[model samples]
Target: MSTDNTLPIEHLRWDAASARGPRELNADATAAVTDPGAGRWAFAVADGVGDNPAAAAAARTAADAAVGAATSDPRGAIMVAREALADAPDTGDCVLVVAVGGAGDRCEIAWVGDCRAYLWAEGTLRQVTEDHTLAAYFRARNLPVAPGMEHVVTTSVRTAAAELIGTADVPLPAGRLLLCSDGVHKTLPTARLRTILERAADPGGAVTDLVDTAHRLGGQDNATALVVDRTAEHTANSSAA
Candidate 1:
C-alpha cells in the first residue's frame, strides 16, 4: 500500500516497534511519516516475500515509496511503490498495508497481501482489512481452506493489477488504531491485543508489549507493530516524539 495524498490530521499520537524473527535477515519494514505543517500523516508496514531475494530492501523501498506519493490515492500509491521497485532490480517484492489520514475524521486504507490494520472503538476491537491470501478468499466464501493457503498471497506490490488491491475508507475512530505485520497478529490473538491496547501505559508501551509478546509466544516471523491513539487525553500521553 502507498500514501501521499497529504490529507490533514491533527491532535493524534502514534508509536511503533519491530523485531527480527528467527530468520537470518529481517524482511519486515515499517514507516510513519507525519507532516505537522499540513496536519497530514501516513503509516505503513511491508513484509518482503521471504522467497524473493533482497526481501529487506524490498520491504523498506515499498514502505518509503508508498508514503512519499499521492497518499489520497491509496491504490495509486501502491502503483507508485510498485513502479519504484521496478527501478531497482535488487529490491524484489513485498506485500503491504497502509493507512493515510488528515483531511478530516476519515482515513483511507489500502493493502496487498496480508499485512493488517485494526480499529478499537466503543469497547470493540475490529479488524479493518481482510487478508488477501487464498486461504482468506476460501474462508470468505465458506469454502474449505486448504493447508498452507494462508501463506499464498494473491497479489503484491510488484505484481498488482486492477482490482488486485483491497481498500476501505473509514471514520478514523477516536479510540485506538493499530497497523501490524503478520508476525505480530498471527502470533498474538485479538483478545490479547485488546488487553495490551487497553492496559497500555502509552502508545510506545503498547507497541513494545505487542512485539515482545509475539516473541514470548514463540512467533517465528519478523514482528512489527504501530499503535495510534486518537482520544484527546491519550493523545497527550502518546506523542510520537
Candidate 2:
C-alpha cells in the first residue's frame, strides 16, 4: 500500500473473501484495487447467473474489467465489462456492482442486476443500491413481489444499456463500505449482517466472518464479500493526548 499526503482521511484499508459454498463450483468473483498514492480505490463483486454454462468465467471477466476501469471512470468501467462479456462463449449473463472511492467521504457506485452495496457507519447499516430484479420492479409499482420472482434479473452487464446502468454518488460515513453478491445477502438478514460487521476487528475479519456466516446458514450459491474502511491518521502527539 502507498500513502496519499493530501487525503483528509489519511488512511484506508480493504479486504475481501469468497466461498464456493456447497455448490459444485464457485461462480462468484470479487476484487479490490487501490491507487493508494492517488487516494483512489475500486471495488467489485460479480455473480455469474446460474443458468449460464460458463458462469464462472463470465463473472471473472466482468469483475476484472470493472476494477481496472473504476478508478478513472465507473460507468465506463461497467460499459467496458459489458462489452467484454458479450464476447464470452455461451457464458450467459452476470449481475455486478462496482464502486469507486476517491479522496474523501464520497464514492460512486454502478450496478446492474441484483448485486448490492451497503454502508455501515456509526452502528447503523443502510443499503446504498437498489436491486434490479422483477421483484423489485413489482414492489416499486405497488404490486405483489410474487414467489420465485426475486431471482429474475431485469438487466445485467450483458443486457443493460449505458443509460440503463444504475449509478449513485454516496457520502461515506465514519465506518465501512460493503459490497456483496446475492448469495451472501439473501442468506443473511440485515440485522445479523450489522452485528457481524460491528463486532469484527478489521476489514479482513469482517469479510471472513460474513462469508463464513453465509455458509453456516446454508448458502445455496457462491458467496463473496468485499469491504473498504477509511480512517484518519493521528500523529504521536494527538495519540498521546
Candidate 3:
C-alpha cells in the first residue's frame, strides 16, 4: 500500500498453510515471474483437493504449466493447465489464478473449485470468483439454512467432473490482487482479511499475516495466499518531469 512509484513492476506477495490440527505438507504451491526488460509479470497459486492424492499432483503440475504458458499466451495458460490436469492420472481438484501483461495493465484470472481471487481497492474487498461449493449452490437456490451445511461442496476440482473452469479479465487498477486457498478463507473472516491487506507494508508481509491469522484461528486445512501489487510504470519521459 505504499505509494512508492519507484518500486519497478509493482510487488507480489504470497502465503500458504496446512490444516489446524496438523497434517502433511500443504497441498498448495505458487509461482511468480517478472520479465526483467518487459515490465510484465505473472503470479499464480494452486490448491489441491484434500480428498484425492492425485489432486495435489494435478494442482502442482497445473500451476507449473500455467506459469510457463503465460509467458507466450496468457489466455492459453488456463487451457494448458486444464489439459495438463486431464492428462495426469489424478482426478483430484485444483484451483488456479494468474495475472500477466503489466504493460497493458491487464490481469487474467482463471480458477476451478473453491479457491478464490480477490481485488482490494478504495478500502473495499471484492471477490472475483464464485465458489463452486454446495453452500453457494444452496444460497443460489434460496434454500433454508441447515446444520452440517459446511459439509456440502457443490463444486470443486475434485468433484466428479472438471466442470468448474472459469476465467476473468480486468484492468489492473492501482491496487492489489490476492489469491488464496480455502484454508485461509475458512478460518478468517473477510473483514479481517481486508484489514490485514490494507495494513500490511508489502505483499510478502500481507501473505504472512493472512497465513498466521488463519493458524491462530484454528487453521483446519492447508492455507495459502498470493498477493500482486500494481502501479503505473514510470517512463523516462515521465520521470524527467
TM-score list, all predictions: 0.89, 0.90, 0.79
Any runs in candidate 3 off by more than 4 Å, and if so which? 1-21, 36-39, 51-53, 71-75, 145-164, 232-241
Model 3 residue 195 lDDT? 96
lDDT of 3 by residue, 192-237 (tens): 9999989988777888889888888887677788877664343232
Candidate 2 wrong stretches, greater than 4 Å: 1-10, 51-53, 234-241
**lDDT (10s digit) by residue, model 1, range 8-49:** 245577788999868677898888677766666788899999
Which order, best to worst by TM-score? 2, 1, 3
Model 3 residue 71 lDDT?
A: 58
Q: How close is candidate 3 to the true structure, as a TM-score?
A: 0.79
What TM-score would you give candidate 1 relative to the actual structure?
Answer: 0.89
Ten residues in a row with the worst lDDT in model 2? Answer: 1-10
* Model 3, position 232: C-alpha lDDT score: 36
Candidate 2 RMSD to the correct structure:
4.0
> Whole-model lDDT, candidate 3?
0.67
Note the Cα lDDT for every prediction shown.
0.83, 0.83, 0.67
